[model samples]
Target: MADVATTVAPLVRRLLGGALPVRLEAWDGSHAGPDVPRGAEALIDDAAAETGHLTIVVRSPDALRRMLFAPGELGMARAYVAGDIDIDGDIFALLDLRHRLGAAGDHVRVGPSLTDIGAVVGILRRLGALGRPLPAPEEEQRRRGRRHSRRRDASAVRHHYDVGNDFYDLVLGPALTYSCAYWGDGVDDLETAQRAKHELVCRKLGLAEGMRVLDVGCGWGSFVIHAARHHGVDAVGITLSPEQADGARARVAEAGLEDRVEIRLQDYRDVTDPPFDAVASVGMFEHVGAAEADTYAAAMAALLVPGGRLLNHAISRPDPHADAGIHARSFIGRYVFPDSALHEVGQVVSALQGAGLEVRDLESLREHYARTLRAWVANLQGDWARAQRLVGPGRARTWRLYMAGSAVAFEAHRISVHQVLAVRPHADGTSAFPATREWLARPLVADGTGGAVGG
Candidate 1:
């Protein structure tokens, strides 16, 4: 068998033949270059080079073959997920390298570039006939049946969320809120930012004492617990994940608000309870695919009473026509959020309007989401070893990469998170919302303890 050094040396040569912006280090202690044709020299990752910023570590020759065979982002992601390739520092900066790879598509008009073809041949020759190496079964998501079917959706949610609550606690901080947080000048911590986010949703919905609120896709009862405790409302939180439902019910009981909060392991389509005074769905909207946007809006509207408000907080795509083939098949879909879809904000508004809901207000919290993801990444990195022990390295890699890549995407405006406040208007066509958006400006009050969320 050829040694790791000889196998990676030629592969590194081919990578450098392009204008990659990082320095590559092989298992045998060989270095590539800081002499990138484009991008900052400081972004290069060389341990001995003082100017290096990022370093790509090639752990094995098979890892190199994985990239060479697949090519492009998916190939790179597979290597990362398989633990064959590792990025040592500033994984966010690796986005720059991805952009370069995307732009290099111009070089392959008809087929693979000469350098790419050569690298594949060289890596394969060294690695031998390793026929179609599959990612660790635990790493890849296997969903059956039609896309977005109820059973399949539940499976997808379970695959991602049923990784154990202890694992999520490490990544999501104390609040256990698995969504974008609302960060402000006063919000300095993850728990605090999450509190601000829940409170913001409550305030936007005009949640009040004795009101009935329904929280769709509620994870661990964060919003439902918050709403029932803080706003003195009867809140029902529903999720498809059995693990989440179990955790949420435990949390509701722990908060001693079991009477006011009901955590149901049910799907939104089957939720028969109607005439909720207010409704909130956070981080759940993205899971409702584009084809089902209208169905989702109509369902929520059917459960809401006239004059009741609904706040839909979800991620949105800037370009509706953008090809998300990479997202659908990459680590995100394979491990993180299988079959999830992000629709344009305008499409969301149209769907809501078509469902007889009035669009009251729309606000972009893109920057806040970026900040939230950065905090999650920090939490994950801080408890890196523990997280790996809890969910294993492959799953941990999924969260770290997904979070960092999403943060950079948010920062670049390639994607965004929006809080769309809408209301089921009365027969007289009145929304009953405050005349101005001033109501949302009020300072949110929380004990900062991550204690029983709401009041």
Candidate 2:
């Protein structure tokens, strides 16, 4: 057969129903798509090109089999995660192609059209690349049992967050936050912006001295520590992951705030304490599943006292369709955030309101989340060696691919992260919330040296 790129180009272009936009290079030193520039190597692998220009490097014949067996996105992701494929010239450039693919629908999933299988089989046979299915990388998580049940949810949480505390610390830095950060104009580091984000939530919740607060799905207890130390609130942070709960408790103890902050290895549904003055759910409800969304909102509402505020911070899609949650078969579902689903802001508002909370304010921190993801990508890439050692190369590659792809999606508005502020009003309709949004933008600290947030 002709060289791999020569044989593969036209066929892929036909399956995609368009001309190829990215350069294709193969392990055998064959190339296709865009003309090779004067000085560049015939088979290029560099990752420094302009946006929208990229190279898909087929590193092994098994990459083709992986794609053949899984089809659509999963096949391609497995190839990438298993080191059979690599993207050259900026992962963003490659990810941008995801939306262009007819079946991808603008997310981490890379769904290239898989039609005309006879043609594909014919081509593969001629190229001597056809083979039976290979075992998926060990890192892929095969979800089992009933979805959204406490037992199943616990398993899913462990799949995503039980990798190791050290692994998260390496990626998330000292703030140990796993959500979007409140970025300041002059902020230069991830940890500082993370700290600002936690403090911002504290202010938004109207936290005050001696007030009781609850943090739902509190990853590593950063929010609880920040509120208790800086705002003097008595705080409870709860998470489903044992690893996260352990890490969060250690952090609270290390901060010398054990008396002020408590971290529990508990689910929000299990809490039966008296009403708290405020409640915050940061980046946690995505795992609540669309089917259990109402339950989640009701739980948060039940935890709050009348006139108490609740900050629901989580990722959302712009789609108005109630069923527009992430596909269960997508890359994120299988390998990254197992059983996670993104609800639109409208759905979230409805749930909160249906649970008897008034949505007071809505803010989209879409751009902030994009930047946060990129920072995490940078941290992972910079410490790639250590990361791979911590989580294995397959899992490490999965994180890199997901974060970079998510950055592209956020920049394009395909998905977003929102901070929805709601309050449980008194029977007579007193919200006790500030009439304006000014309170949310206060300086990070009283002295003002730490800089302003949400400004």
Candidate 3:
């Protein structure tokens, strides 16, 4: 029986090779890799040192075996998710190292190279007696049945949104609005910004007193309550998550607007009524898979009366060729938003037009979403202990990593959020929209107090 440290030392040696730019420390009190870059002396903590120093603590030898068996991103992800490996230094730098090692020509491919395969084989051959491969964490989702089907969509939505409303409350502020907020007009507070966002959507859709509005994928009834209480519209909100529907109904009742607001656990496709004067779908379009985008647009178009307005607010991937489904092997699909899909803005516009709706206005809220995510990250970090207790450590870590990464992506313009306003034209070929965008600039205050109306 050999000690674990002795078993892994040779593997680490072969893994780093001779010309090492990084330092690797093992949990067994053994060190490998060059003390410094191939040619330079070790500075206290220079940028190079920052990028090069990585502290890896292996909880179990099985972790290394699993990593070596699979290799590349999926293997690496499994090790982290299973709590077998921990990286103490910069995670992004480690990602960069992986990119550098896997680059081909001018492009960086996420797949492993032949060198990577050879290295894994060598590691396994030397330390094959350690342990057998372990199954991935129970958290990884593998939904069965047809994709985007009504029942399947409900399961997917519940998997993500039904993770305890208390957990969501800690992440989202008092308003509990999960979508990107409107941060314009010097609105610096989260609650205020969220209200401003709902107000902006109402103004864009031209909601008025007695006008009927349908809020698709309405989370917690934030927008529905806001529209009914603030915009004087008779609003109905629908969601696939039963928890959200319950919370939203309670919220509407609490707002004392039960006569004007209705929240249901219903699917967009199941919506049979079509007399709504205006419709708003915020943060919901992403759930409509690319394959279902046409159906979604057509459904919304049919729901609206002639000359009615529709506002589709959703996040979009800037890369034209990015997959609409969750990124390959990403944590978002495994733990966060299972079965979610994101479409490009152009694709969204085309779908709307194909559904017989004429595009009237388009606004990008990319930076606002970045700011909103940063706030959510701060809130989660602030209540880290409670979050872990609510959702367990693995799920909490998933949220932190994904939220921080999404904020960076939004700031870098790798992705964006857009509000696409289109209207069902009258027979006269007029959209009935104001000739100018001036109507949106007016401050329409339906309530004197600026606090959040309902849950």
Candidate 4:
């Protein structure tokens, strides 16, 4: 057994590259690797060396055991939460590696499938953590003082989205959409589902050639370019992030739609456009605090013509109490996204109506968002180092926690994503639904198969 362990140690070292060192030992002293120093303990086979500066241990095999024979993602997440596995250098980096390796096709298949009741129970139990109250803030005055403002918003946003362009490029496919991909339930791949979501928004807005459209919080301006190039509408995109604004502008030029599409770095409140034919705010509602929901709705209503349509895509909770005990508000407000608050669908509807907009359509995108987050997590895991460099260690860890937590929330039915279509009434107080079918008839799917998910 000792001879066998000695031979396997060199093979393990070769697999991880010389940069990573390994020491292996059997449960009995009969077998041990040369690197295993005397008196050092043996770790389970599932463990992996993680830290760059130290030989940090990963309980991967143990985690896999819990996941395969018990719960899966939820189980692994709980192991981290409980400190069953220790990560030395960067927790986010370790998470990224786990996500990438676990999501690989073979590894994903190895887990007890979601259909397994035990696995589901384990996942639910882990997700139960999200319902627990947040830890009390430290006694330090500096930490308490830091929570009062939006100072961390910029850093938080950058931490999550500013991972290298190449990293995002690998996961998001051609459209580069970072928000929910509207899968039409039966859709097989993410790309088709995402394109369908884009088209669905365009259709709901009743977009026409030469009409003006405004997209608020437009990440990378995918919708702006899509509206102009595909729908023949002139589009303007507004975003608070300089990186997004610059990238969108470059993309617009590359698409030869520079004349038709405009991108700006501006806050939603400052948008003074008189009346656009259509307005869309995608994946940005969460940033508007509860105190700002009314203002946000009013801003959209004000920008649209009397008969104009507005499409708002946002993450929401089923009810106000969904995250009641979770301290989600404080966690996100401080460590993750500052001044961000998720609204319930009812709350959003009331705000829109109060702002004088009538609800035309409402769709729950819970499952779609679940799939989208899963894809994103997998992508981020594949580009761990690049992600770490783009956002510092702490920030990166915060994002991973947020994303993984969000996925669990969605899967457990604690949270949801929604697309609400609204219309500003005409002077006569009537809706203009005429010709709606024509717009809706266009092939939502690129391949002519209408089997896609969302709309």
Candidate 5:
């Protein structure tokens, strides 16, 4: 064991670009640089050199062995949650390394056919008779709880969005739009697609100069600031996180958009002003608990003018049963996001209809989200260390698992994201939009594959 550690430690250090301080000890022997706790049967130094600034202690090799070879992703993440493996440095860096190593076809390699065999085995194991029974109806009900629970709200949004902006900044291209990319004809790269997506929404609602727009669940206030600055719209954005609101305010002020955009840290229910000409809620609906769907729709309806339009971009599950047995709800509810619920496409349509909104357009963005997540995971892998300092080990692990799992889910067609454009019918029952597809198809700038910047 000591020999193996001695050999692997240097290799790992080389991979991490620095010398790592490690202590390896077996049952009857100890090789000391840093003290290995007494009674620690097997100890391997897995700590990287960059992590020296953190105050965390290293765990014994025995504990790490159990965690690394765990049967499921959940078990591996649970080890971090249980403090079985100590990451003395940035947890995000450690997690990024783990994710990159796991995805780099190194950790558990198999040929295509053998990989299929292993997947079959894993599926069977998850469905085995010895597995835990399904949650009882009452327990399932308790899982949803309430949207107003501060603890639940914090857990839900923080689990996904709070994974550090730098990590997202790497993979999300220059726009920093974390939602699905619009891959229409001639759109290839992430930045173009994201910009197209933004412009598409703006055009769909016919955003005009001096128009007042309410952006619900505005992430980073991207749409609000962009619309106000570039399109000459008056925009107000609302978010649940104080960090997001503060950051968005800074961004708005930096762009000299304080006159056109206002961001507030407030719940959607608190938005009581009426008669906004246009509204948008992008990548935010999933956090609205199932019970609050109607309330959410009504809030949007109340905020809109008589014939206002609303563009909603959200991820959707094919069915409620899709998430069963994946521990998705539990992990998302507990570690990552709380009080969040995914709706079926039908459910979204029904809710919009019930709120007296007429659906004008619908687009499936499953492939785009899958690609987006892949990009995000790559970005997260690149900047893991700094991210860990922002959150913690447990949180870092939770995000890695969540993003990877979501990527797999999208790839497998178990989940999807969508963009739905809807409108509150006019008193005369006619849409004010004048053929939106023409503007949507117009080229913003020429494709710049030659390393040239586009407009």
Candidate 6:
């Protein structure tokens, strides 16, 4: 009976079809998996390692104990968050392992073979991993109250956003825009791509001088200030996080755009002012649960005047059937976005149409989000000490895992994002729209410093 890497290696290899794509280093100073040549050996042993491709480290017996009790993602997530285990290499490799396991099919999930279970249990017993389930990390959150109720929604928002402005500033870059960026041709770097994204949104909404705009779930007033200062629009940005509202207001004041922009700590449902020229909900629609889709669509509709545009930019499930029976209640649901939900792009369009907003455009930015997330992960890892200092180790680990995992997920197309441009047509069934999309791609200064004049 050994708790060494050899014991753990065989089990994982058996589960993943007898060959581990990743190296495993167990708590007992033993290692297993592929024999790498020379320096490539470290290529993937560090989860945050840029050159690393595949390494999973069981730092303690508790890592296995946690997994033994919980199984699947949750247990693994807890082990990672608690520092019981560490990863080296590309997270995508883990996904690949799952793909291999899927070939094992029903045996893996529906009902694992009894012999297989017995083997795992026997190994765990030998490794001293069979025990009471460890407590979940304190960082894990499960929201209370009615789902999407204004109060509960606010809690969920704060849980994700209250992580501090400085920390977000570091991860999100100077743009401070937390959404899928436009990685258009020759557009490199996070800040530039993010500005391109905002500019693209402004154009899609047809923003111009004297127009009134609303930014729902505005993170920190970047969009509203951009709209008002550059596009000359009177903009109102609303958010559920008090910290975010304060940060946005402070930013607006700093920009001397106080007269043109307002940051309200309010939910979209509580907004009373209407007849705006356009509305923008970027990266925030996930919190609007599927059950509240109509309410969300109607609210956006109610906020726009006739002929005004609404750009609902959100991460969406690739298809309604794609996520069927798959649960979001895994690690992300319990930790990062407690009550979030993703709907299919078509379903989103249907909801908007149900509220009388004509769905105009749906462009997938799936790859762009992957790029954005990769940049963010790099930023966090680059300044990891600072990040850990700002948010503590557990939260820092959470963000690193969340952002990197998201980047890979986006690349895999397991999830997607879209910029949905819709319009509130006039009573006569008329709405203003350009005949071509050529104007939307006018190249701007990649750094967001000078140029890229807004209309």
TM-score of each: 0.88, 0.92, 0.84, 0.65, 0.67, 0.90
Instruction: For candidate 6, give the lDDT.
Output: 0.78
Residues 164-212 of candidate 6 have per-residue lDDT tens digits of: 9999999999999988888777777787777778888887888889999
Please, what is the whole-model Cα lDDT of each candidate in the order they appear? 0.77, 0.82, 0.75, 0.62, 0.61, 0.78
Which candidate should be chosen as best, given lDDT against the real structure?
Answer: 2
- Cα lDDT tens digits for candidate 5, 1-455: 23333323333343334333444332233233235443333232445344344323324333333223333343344444545434444433333444323332111111112223343344334323123322221111123445456555654565466555655565465677767766667766777777667766787777878899998888777778767765789999988776677777888898889988999877777787768999999988878766778888888878888778999888887775443122342444445555566788778888988998888888888987877776666666567686566666556555655676566667656678888888988778776655556656565443444211122
**Winning model by TM-score:** 2
In TM-score terms, candidate 1 sits at: 0.88
Q: How big is the RMSD of model 6?
A: 4.3
Instruction: Report the C-alpha lDDT of model 4 over 145-196, residue by residue, as the tens digit.
Output: 2421344444445544565565466557667787898766467677777778
lDDT of 1 by residue, 147-228 (tens): 8899998988888889999999998989899999877676688887888888889889988899999999999998888888
Per-residue CA lDDT of candidate 2, range 31-124, in tens? 8766665332233223224345567888888877877778778888889999999877678666765544553443755534467456667767
lDDT of 3 by residue, 301-354 (tens): 999999999999999877667777775355566666767788889889999999
| Global Cα lDDT for candidate 5 | 0.61
